[model samples]
Target chain A: METTHAARAGRGMTALRRTSGIIAAVTLTTSLAACAGGAIGGGTEGGDDVFKVGLISPVTGPVVQEATAMQRGFELAIEKINAEGGVLGQPVEVVTVDDQADAAKSTQLAQRLISQDQVDYIFGTIPGDTTAAVAQVAESAKVPFSSAILGNAGVCGQYFFPFGEPNASLLNGLLPQMIADHGTKVALVGNDYAFPRGYFADARTVLEELGATVVLEEYSPMGTADWQPVISKIKAAAPDWVLTAVVGADATALVTQADQAGILDSMGFTGVSLIADFYPGLTDRMHGLTLVGRYSDQLDNEANKEFVDAFREAYDFSDPIPSVAANAYEGMLMIADAVEQAGSTEGADIAKALGEGEVENGVFGGGSFNEDRFFMTETARFEIREGGAYVPVETFPADIEGITPRCA
Target chain B: MDAVVTLALSVFTLFGFYALLAVGMGLIFGQLGVVNVAHGELVMVGAFVMFALADVPFLPRLLLAVLIGLVLGVVIERLVLSNLYERGFLATLLAMWGVSIVLREGANAIFGSTPASVRAPIQENIEILGVSYPLYRLIIAVVALAIVAAVLLVTYRTKLGLVVRATVDNRDMASVLGIPPRLVVTGTFAVGAMLAVLAGALQSPLLGVTPMVGAAFLAPAFFAVLLGRAGSLPGAIFGAFVVALLSTVLRTYLNETLAQVVLFALLIVLVAVRPNGIDWRKVQWKPRTQPAQVAA
Candidate 1:
C-alpha cells in the first residue's frame, strides 16, 4: 500500500513540474515578445500638420555610445530646427527606436516606425547592419531614409540617401594622406565581415595607387578577445602604419591587448572611423593613434562652433562630441532642407529633393548630395592626445565622390 | 623563437580564461545533467559587480564577486533548478535558457545598455623572456590556474567530493545511501558559479564589459566542454587548453572567418571519433568508506 502511494506521488510530482515548466516558458516568451513589440508601437500619432521623422539608433547594444551620440545629435538638430520655426511649416516630431544593433530587432522596429508611427522621414544609424535593416524597411515603404554611417556595402538603394563615406570614398579620401604622412607600408586589421573586407579591398587599391606597399593584412571575427596571435604577426611584419576597422567592443579588446603586448610602440596606428566614441577610454593609449572621419570636434568654423555650443547647452557639455554626432546632426539638417525644397513631406518628393538639394552650411563642413546621391563632405584627420582629447591635424578636400551602387 | 614563445603564452593566457568557464559549466552538467545556458550570464554578472565596485580595489572586488555568485547561485538553485531537477534534461535546459534571457535583459534594463569597464590594477607591461606583455593578463592567467587547482583539490580530496562523485555515478543509489543529492548538487553548482564569476571579474580589465559580452565567451567555453570529458573536471580543463591552443594557432595562420569554419569542422570530427569525449568514468577513484577517512 505504501509503495503504491509513493509511486502515485512521484508521477503526480513529475506532471506538476512539467506543467510548471511549460507555463514558465510560455510566460517568458510571451512577455519578451510583448516587450519588444510594445516598445515600437506607442508613438504619439501626429496629424498631417506634424512631420514625424523616425530615428533608428542602437541604443542598447555593443555600439551604444555611438548610438547615443547619434541620438543626441538628432535631438539637438530637432531643438535647433524647432527654435528656427520648424521644417516645412510643421513641427518636426522625432520618434526614436532602439534597434540594439541586432538586425532582427532593427527590422521589427523599422516596420513599427513606418506602419504604426507613420513617420514621414527616417534616419538610419551608426552600426552598418542596423542601418541596412532600417534601409530595407524604408525602401519597401518608399520613405525618404538617410544614413549618417552606413558601411561600404551599398546596402541602401532607391529611396535611401547615404551621405557618409562609403568604403571606397573613405579609403580614397583618407589613405592617401595617411600613406604620405606615415610610411607607405601599411598593415590592415579589421573584423571579418563584408564591410571590413570591402574596406580592405578599397585600401589596397588606394594605397597601392598612392605608391604605398600593403605589408600585412589580418582579420578577426567580431567580439574576439584574444588578439595576441594577430599582434605577434603584426610585430613580425613591422608595418609602417597599422590601420584597423575592428569596431565596437572588439575594438576595445584589440586596443587593450595591443597596448599590453607593446605592439602600439612599434607601429604608428591609424584607423577608419574609430576614435570618436571610444576616445575617453583610450586616452593613455592614444599617443601615436590617428583616425579619419568627416567631422571632428576641433573643426575651427562658425557653423561647427555654433553646433558644438548648442550641443553643450542641451546635453552633457563636458563629454566629447563624437564625429558620429556631427554626421547625424548634419543628416537631420539635410532632411529638413530636402523637405523644404520638396515642399512636401511625402517620401518620394523628399527623396527627389534630397538628390537635388544642397545642405548649404550644416555641421559636417557643408556639402551636397552628388550625382550618385551620396553626401560629399571633406574628411579630416585627428591625433588623439594623452588626456582623451583629439587635435585636428589635417583636412582633405571632398574629392572622393560616392560610388555608384550595383547591389540589386 | 620569440614568435613561438609569444604564441605559446597567448594560447596559455586564453586557456586560463577558458578553463574557468569550461570547468564551471562541466561541474554543473556533471552533477545535474543539464547545460546551464546561464553560465555566461553569471560571468557577466561578475563583470558588472566589478564595475559597480570600481571604487574598491581589484582583489576585494573579485572576492565580493565570488560572494555574490555564491548567493546568486543558491537562490537560482533553490527557487528554480531544484524543482526541475527530476523533470528531465529538456525541461532544465529550457528553464535555464529562460533564466539567461531574464538576467541578460535585466542587466540591459538596469545598466541602460551602455558598456561599462573597470581599470586594470596592473597597468604596466611585464617583460618575460625579452617579450613585453600586460602584467594584468599574466596575473589573470595565474589566478585562473590557481582557481582550477583549488577546485580540483576540493573535488578529489573532500568527503563532499565523494558524495558528489557517488551522486554523479548513480544518483538513486547515492540517495539510498543517505547522501543528500540536492545539497551536493546545489553546493557543487554554487562553487562552479563562484569560479566563473571570479574569472569574469579578473578578466574584466582586458575585455569590454557590456550586457551581452558574455555571448563572446560562450561558444569557446562550450566547445571546450564539448570536446572534453562530459563529467570529468580534469578533462574539461585539459580540453580548454587544447581548444585555446588550436583556436589561437588557427586564427593566427588563417583569417578569422576561415579559422572558425575549420575549428567547427575539427570539433565535429572529434565528436564523431570520441562519441563520449575521452571517457574518464572508466578510471576508478576509490572512495573512502567513512567520511572521517577523507583527506584534509
Candidate 2:
C-alpha cells in the first residue's frame, strides 16, 4: 500500500485525483510490462550462469519459529542439491529477505526480488494471505512462485506451483476417522484471521458431510491474552472434541489455559498446526492428541530418514520438526528437479517443468500435482508422544483426483 | 446468567493486570512527565525472568523478577532516560522506544523466539457463581488488586505521600525544603516499573511468553492510562476498570473482531469527549448565577 500510494502520487495529476487516473495507471502498467521483459526472455542475461530464486520469508513475527524451520530446511535442500552435481549444472542461488508475515511487506519484497535481484523464481512465506500477496506480485512479474504451506487449492495461476498440503487433502485425510472415533459434536476455535476462518469453513463442511454437528464456532483476535471468556463459552457448548486453528503465541495460550481449565481433559483437542511448533510451550499437555498433515519426520521411509537426520544434525534440533519445514525440503527438491527438467534458467520454463514433472524421490514420497497445480502429498496421522515426537500412526494416500473447484 | 457471571469474572481478571500496567504508566506520565514507551517490554522482561528461572518456586521467582525490574528500571533511567528528560518529551519517548527494541531483541536472542510458559503457582478449579473458574486466576486477581490498594494507601495516606505530592506539585519549592526531586523521580520510575513487572509475573502462567508478547499489552494499558486524569492514581484504576469491563462485555456479546472494533470506537468517543480524562470524584454542582453569556 505504501509503494502503491507513492507510485500513484508520483504519476497522478492533481486535477484527476477525484476521478480515474487512467493516464498514470496506463503508464505504470506499461512500465511494469517492460520491466518483465527479462522473464519473457529465455535468460536473465546474467554472467554467472547460476539458477537463482528469491525467498520472501517471515523471520520475525508470530510464525517466526515456523519460518526459521522452513529456512533451515530450504537451505539444507539447496546445500544437498548443489553438492550432488547441482541444478541445470550450476548451483542454485537463493536471495533471502524477511517480510515479517505481513502481506504488504511481502508484496514489496516480492517486487524487489523480481526487479532488483533479477531472480528466476520466488518462494515462501507462511499463512494463505501472504501467499496471496506474493502470488499477485509473482503473477504480475510473470515469475513462478511457490510455498511449502497449506492453503486452499483454488489459489491457482499459470506461474504458481504449490508443493505443500492444501485444505482438501488435510480435511479429507483427517476428518473422517476423527469424526468416526470421537463423536459427532465438534467445536471450531481459532484466531480470527483469513487462514483459520477459511480453514474452519472447510473443516465445518467436512464435519457435516461426515454426519457430525459443529457445536460451536469461535474466533478470537490475534494476541488475545485473556481467553477465559472464550474458554467459558466453549465449555458451556460441551462438544466432544475441539478442532482449533490458533497459531503462534495464541496457540500456546489457548491450549495452556484450556488445560488449566480442564477442557482438554474433558473433551479431546486436535487441530492442524497445533502440536509441533508449539511443543516447547505445551510439553506434556500434547501427549495424547493426534493430528493429520502432509509431512512428519517419523514417516517410515528411507528418504525421510535421511532428510530428518540431516535436518536434526544441521540445526541441532531435538523437538518435533514442523510440517512446514518438511514441506520446504520437498518444495526445494521439486523446484530443483523442475529446473533440471526445464533445461533453462527461465521463469516460464521452470514453471512449465514444475507442471509437467513429478517429484523425483523427494521426502513425503514422490508424487505429482492433483490437477489444479496442488501437490498431492500423502497425509499422515500422528500421535503426540512425550518427547516432542509426532509418532506416525496412519497414512492417507495421495489419491485425490480432479480440481474440486473452490474459486469462482 | 453464566455468561454474565463469566463476563464479570473475566473483566475482574483483566482489570487486575490493566490496573497494574496503567498505574505504572500513569505514574511515569504523571511524575516524570515522560512516557515510558518501553513499559510493556518491562513486562516481557518479567515474563522471561519467570521462563528462565523455571526451576525456582513460583513465589520466589516472582520476587526475583520484581527485584530485577527495580534494578533494570534504575539502570535504564540513569543511563538512557535521566538526561533525555531535560532535552524534551520526544527525546525521552524516543529513547524509551529504543530501549524497548533492545529489551525485546535481547530477550529473543537469549530465549529464542519459540513461545515459553511458566507453571502457575497454584492450580485448582473452584466454582464461582455457576461457573468453574481457575483458583489461580482468582487468587492472582485478588493479589494484584491488593497490591494496587497498598500502593494507593502509601500514595494518599502516608507522610511520604505528602512529600512526593509536594515535589510533583512544585519541585523547585520541594527542593528548597531538602527534598531531592531527582531521587524522587528515579524512585517513582523504579516503583512504576516494579508494578508492571509484578503484573507480568503474575500473568505469565496465562501468557505464551515470547519476545513479541509485550506489544499486545501496550495498547490496552495505554488507553487505560489515557482514560484517567493526569497524576490521579485512583482515576487510573478506574480507567482500567472501564476499559476492562467494556472490552469483556462487548466480547461476551459479540465476536472478538467486532468487540475490538466497538471497544476502539468507544474509547475514541470517550477520549474525544474527555481529553483530560474521567474523575468521578471531581463531580460537583454549581448554583446557576446567569442564563449564560455566549463568549464571542
Candidate 3:
C-alpha cells in the first residue's frame, strides 16, 4: 500500500511541471504580440503611394481665425498640385496637428511630426513665440520648417524658411511716412504680450528716429475689456496720433472704445494692420484708421483676385483673407517646387534647391528665397473705411537698404 | 515724464477695480462657508447685461445691472448651493468649477468668439499731481468705495445682519429659534452674487466684456478672500489691495512671470503661517453635547 501511494505522488508532481510550462509559453507569446502591436501602430511610416507633409497650426484659442484660413489655403494649394500631377508621381498627403497657439505645444507637435509622422516637410506656426519654439527642434532634426504666420526676426534657423516680412521691420518701414503725415506727438498702446510688446518697442525706436515724441505708452493684459481709464488718460495726453499693436478681439475692443470716446476722429489712429481676417465686422468703427500690412483685399493681381474670389465662394461670404494664409499657401508650393528641382525628398537636397535663387510663380507675386531662405515680398498699406472694407493706399517693396544679416 | 505719470495712473485704476472684486469675494466666503468659484462669471454676466442696456443711458444701466446681480444671486443659491450644503467642501468646489465652465462656454457659444465692448458714458480726463487721469476711472473708484461703505453699514447696523451673524454662529440654534436658516443662507448668497455682478458691470468700460475675462478676476478674488480670512469683509478688501499693490509693483519693476511667482509665494507663506486665516480668532469653537443615558 505504501509503494502505490509514493508512485501516485510522483505522477502528480510531473503533471504540475507540464501545466507550469504551458502557462509560461502563453505569457511570453502575449508579451511579444503587445510589443509588435505598438511598433505597427506608431506614426512613423508614410504609406506607399503618398508623400506625407505635416501641417502644425493654432486652430483654437485667440488666433483660430488666422489658423483656419491657413489650413484652407494649404488645402487649396494641395488640390492645385494634385490636379496637374502630384510630387514625384505620387499623391501628396497632409497630416494636421493643432498647437492651440501655445509655444511649448508647438515644439512637441513639430517633434512628433518629424519623428513619428515621418512627414516629408512641415509647415505653419502663427505667432512669433510659437515659431521660435518649433524652429530649434526642426533645425536639429534637419527637417525643413516653413512658417506662414510668424514674421519675427528672432526666427532664423538654418533649416527654417520665414515667408513674411518681420513685424518690427514692417512697422519701422512705415514710421517716417506716418510721422510726416500725422505729426510728431504720438501715443503707443499694445497688448501686454511678446509680439505687441516687441513690435511696440520697435515702433518707438523708429518714431523717435523720425522726430516724433511718444507722449504715452500703455499696455493692457490680453483680453482686458474696460478701456475707460486708458481712454481718459489718452484724452488728457492728447497725442497727435495713436499707434496700436493689438491683435484679434482686443483690436476690435480698442477701435470700438476709441470710436465711442470720439478719440478716433480727433487722433490719427494707425495700427500694425490686423485687418485681413475680421475687417468686415469692424468697418463701422475702423473707418479712417490706417493699417500696415502685406496683402490688401483690393490688390488687383490675378492670383490675388482669384484667391479672394475662391475664398468668398467657398465661405459664401466676403471673408477677409489673412496674409499669413497666403504666405503659408505659397510656402507649400515653394516646397513642392524645391523637391521637383532637387529630384529627391531628402531634406538637405531640398534645402539647397530652395536657396538656389530660382524665381517661381506663387500666390504672392514673384516668390523667391534669399540666401537665408526668407521670402522677398513687398508690403502694402490699407485704410479702413466706415463700412469695414479695406481700401488699398500704397505698396512698399522689401527695404533692401535695411536688410541686415541673419542674427541667428 | 508724461509716460511715467500715465503709467502710474493706469496702475491705480486697475487697483481700484481689483479692490471691488476682492471685497465681494471676501464677504461671501467670510460669512458663508461657500467658496464662490463662479464669482467672476457672475461679474461677466452683469457686464454683458449692463452692455445690452447701456443705450438706455448711464444711471439706468447701473440700476439695471444691480437688479440683474440680485436675480442672479437668488438663482445661484436655489439652483446650485442648496443641494451642496450637506455634501461638504469637495462637492461645493467641484460644483462651482463645473458651473464656471458651463457659463464661460455658454457665453462663448452665444456671443460667438469675438469680444464685445461698452463705451464709457463719460469721456473726460482730469489732471492731478502732474499726471493725466481718466475721469471715468475716478468715478469708478468713488462708486466702488461708496458700495464698500454701504455693505459695511448693512452688515453691522441692520437687524438682518444680526440674524446672519446668528446663523453663522450656530445654524441649529438659529433654526430652532425661528430664525429660518434656509432664508438667511439664501439671502446672504444672493447678496454676495449681486455685489459681484455690480463690480463686473462697473468694470465693463475699462476691460470690455469677454467670456474668459472672469477667470482673470476669479484668481485674484480667491487670493484676497483666503488672505483676509474666510469670513471677514474688511479683511478681504485689505487682501485685495495688498495683492494689487504687489502685482503692480512687481509688474512695473520685474518680469511678468516673476511677478506672478512672487504673488504665489507670498500666498503660500500667508497660508502656512496662518492656516485658519487672518481672522480665525472671530470663529467660536463649541464642545460636543453628550447623549442622554438610556433607562433600564
Candidate 4:
C-alpha cells in the first residue's frame, strides 16, 4: 500500500513538470510574437519622414579590411550629418548587410533592404560582383545607389554612381610612368576572373603604347593552394616588372612567395587593384612593392589629416584607412550634399543634384560626375616605406576625359 | 634543368599534403560507408587550432590539433552519427552536411572571418639541386611523407588493423564475431580526423589561414577519392599522387581554367573505363544473385 501511494505521487509530479514545460513554451512564443510585431510597426512609424540608407559590404570574408573601412566611412559621415540636423528635418538611419563577397547573397540582402526595411538609398560595395548585384536591385527599385570600390564598367547602370576611380583612368595615369621607370618588359600574373582580366585588358593597351611587351600572362584559379609553379615561370621569364592583378589572399600568397623567392628584391611590383592593406602583416617582405591608390596614410594634405583625425575620433579605427574607404567616405559626404541641395529625399532629384556639381569640397577635393555616372577624382601612387606604411610618391589630377566603359 | 628540379620538388611537396587529405577521406568512406561532408570543416578546425596556438612551436601545436580533432570526432560520432548509422546513406549524408554548415557558420560567428596568419617556424630558404626553395615547404613535405608511412604501418601491421579491415568488409559479420563495430567506426573516424587536422596545421602557413580555406582543398580531395579505389588505403594514396601530378603539370603548362577542364574530362574517362578506380585488382567484380535490401 505504501509503494502504490509513492507511485501515484511520482506520476502526479511528472504531470506537473509536463504542464510547466508547455506553459513556458507558450509564454516564450507569445513574447517573441509581440517583439516581432513591435519591430515591424516601429519600422513603419514616420514612414517617408525617416531617410533610410542601406549599406551592402563584404563584412566577414577575405575583404574584411575594405568592408570595415567602408563601414567606418559611412558611420562617420552619418554621424556628422545627424549632428547637424539630418536631411529634410528627419534623422538619417543606416542598415548594414554583410554580403561576404557572394553575389547571390548580395541580391537577397539588397531585396530585403528594399522590400523589408524600406530603405530609400542604397550605398555599397567593395567587390565587383557584389556591386553589380546591388546596382541591379537598386536600378529596379529606383533607389539611388553608389559603388565605393568597384571600378569596372560592366557594373555601371542608369541609377548607379561609381565613386572609385575606374580601372581605365587608374591605368592611364599610372602605367606610363611605371613603364618608363621599371622597364619595357612586364609579366602579368592574375587570378582567372573578369575583374582581373578587365584590368589586364586596360593595362595591355597602355603597355603596348609605351613600347613595353607583356613577357608572360598567367592566370590562376581562385583558392589555388600552390603558387611555386607560377613563381618559377615568372623567374624564368625574368620580366623587368611583375604586374599582379590578384587580390585578397592570393595577392598575399603571391607577394609572400615572390619575396621568399627573392623576386621582389630584384623586380618592381606594380599593378591595379593589388591592395596593400595586408602589407603590414608582411612588413619584412614589402621592401620593393609599389601600388597606385587614391588614399595614403602618409599624405601631407590638411584635408587628409582632418579626415583621418575625424575618422579615428569617430570609429576608434587606428589602422591606415584603405583607399576604398576614402572613396566611400567621399561618396557619403557627396550624397549628403546632393540631398541637401536637391531639397528632397527622392532618388532622381539627388542623382540630378549630384550630376549638376553640388559636392565640390570632397575628401580629396575636386569631385565631379561624368555622363557615365563615374566619379572623376584624383589618383595617387604610393610605395611601401622602410617600416610598413605607404608613403605618397605622386598624385594625378582629376580627368575630364572620364571613365571609358567596358560595356554598353 | 634547375627549373625541372624545382618543378619536381613542388610536385613531391604537394603530393604529401594531398595524400594526407585523400587517405583520411578514403578511410572514412571505406569503413563508415558515410561520405563525411564535414571533412573540410575538420581541416578548418585544424587551421584554427594552429592559429589559436600560434606562439607554440609547430610540432607541439600540431600534436594539440590532432588531440582536439580526435576528441571532436569521437563526440560527433557518439552524439550525432551513432544514431544515423542504421538510417541509410541519404540520412547520414544530410546529417553530415548539416553538421558542415553548422561548423562553418560557427567558425564565422566565433572568429569573425578575419584573416589570421601563421608565422612559419622555419623561415629560411634551402637550396635543392641548384634551386632555392622555402625551408618550411621542405619541412612540410618531409613530415607529411613520414605521417603517411606511419599511418600505413599502423593500418597494415597491427591487431587493430585486422579488426578495422574486418569491419570494413562486413559490419554484421564483424559484430557477430564479437568485435564491436561501433568502436572500430569511432577509432577509424578519430584517426581520419587527426590526419586532416595535421594536414591543415602543416599547410596553414602556405595558404594563409581563413575560415573558408578548407573549401579550396575539398574538391581536390574528393576527386582523389573518386580516382582511387574507394575502400582501399594504398589506392587512395596512389590516386592522390596521380591527381597532384596532373594538377601541377597542367597548371604549369596551361592556364588554371583549361587545366580543370582537362582534369574533369580525364576523371570521366577513368570512371567509364574502370569503375573501381585503381583498386580493381584487389577487389573482383562479382555478379550478385540477391537484390539489395534496406537495413532494418
Please name the candidate that would achieve the greatest lDDT relative to the true structure. Answer: 2
Output the number of the TM-score-best candidate: 2
lDDT of 3 by residue, A1-408 (tens): 122322322332232224325446754565445323322122435664346787876765567666877877787778767776988886677778777777877877788778878877888868778887888888898887787764554657777887766664477556766787778999888777777766676677677767889998877766645454556657767898888876666676667667655777777887753465556335556666677766665667777777777666765545456777677667777778788887877777777887774544445567576655567776667777655556668777755333334542
Q: Write the per-residue lDDT of candidate 2 for residues B1-296, one digit (tens) a residue.
A: 88777778888988988888988887777666666768889999988899999999888998999899899889888898888865756576668878888999999898888889888877788898878888898888899999989888988899887777777666778889999988887888899988888888889999899998888888788777668775577877899999999988888778788989999899879866876678676565886587778899
Highest DockQ scorer: 1
Question: Is model 2 an incorrect, acceptable, medium or high docking prediction?
Answer: acceptable
Per-residue CA lDDT of model 2 for A66-89, tens digit only, reads 789888888888899999988778
Per-residue lDDT tens digits for candidate 3, residues B1-296, read: 75566556566666677778876766566666566778899888877777677578877888888887888778878898889866754465556666777877787767644455666777776777775456887788778878877887788789878888777667788888899988888888888888888888887765546676676687677766666644667777777776776666665655444556787788768756764456635555786688999999
* Clash count list over all predictions: 1, 0, 14, 0
**After superposition, which runs of candidate 3 have C-alpha atoms over 4 Å from their true positions?**
A1-45, A60-69, A72-91, A183-194, A197-242, A249-269, A273-285, A312-320, A333-345, A349-363, A400-408, B1-16, B48-81, B124-135, B179-187, B243-296
TM-score: which is higher, 3 or 4? 4
- Where model 4 places Cα greater than 4 Å from the true spot, the runs are A1-42, A45-49, A58-65, A95-118, A133-142, A272-274, A300-318, A358-362, A386-388, A399-403, A406-408, B169-181, B280-296
Fnat of all models, as shown: 0.36, 0.46, 0.11, 0.28
Fraction of true contacts reproduced, model 3?
0.11
Evaluate all candidate structures by whole-model CA lDDT and list the values in order: 0.74, 0.79, 0.69, 0.73
Q: List candidate 2 segments past 4 Å from native.
A: A1-45, A399-408, B282-296
TM-score of chain A of each: 0.85, 0.85, 0.83, 0.83
In the range A104-160, model 4's lDDT, one tens digit per residue, is 777777888888888878887677777788889998988889878745646766678
* Residue A145 of model 1, lDDT score: 83
Question: On a 0 to 100 scale, what is the lDDT of residue B168 in model 1?
Answer: 65
RMSD of 4: 9.8
| Model 1 per-residue lDDT tens digits across residues B1-296 | 77777777888889899999988987877555666778888888888899888899878888899999998888888888889866766677778878888888888777644445578888787778877777788778988989888888888998878787777666677789999878887887788878778878888887767777787777677667666654667877887987888888887788777988898788668756774565645655786476566567
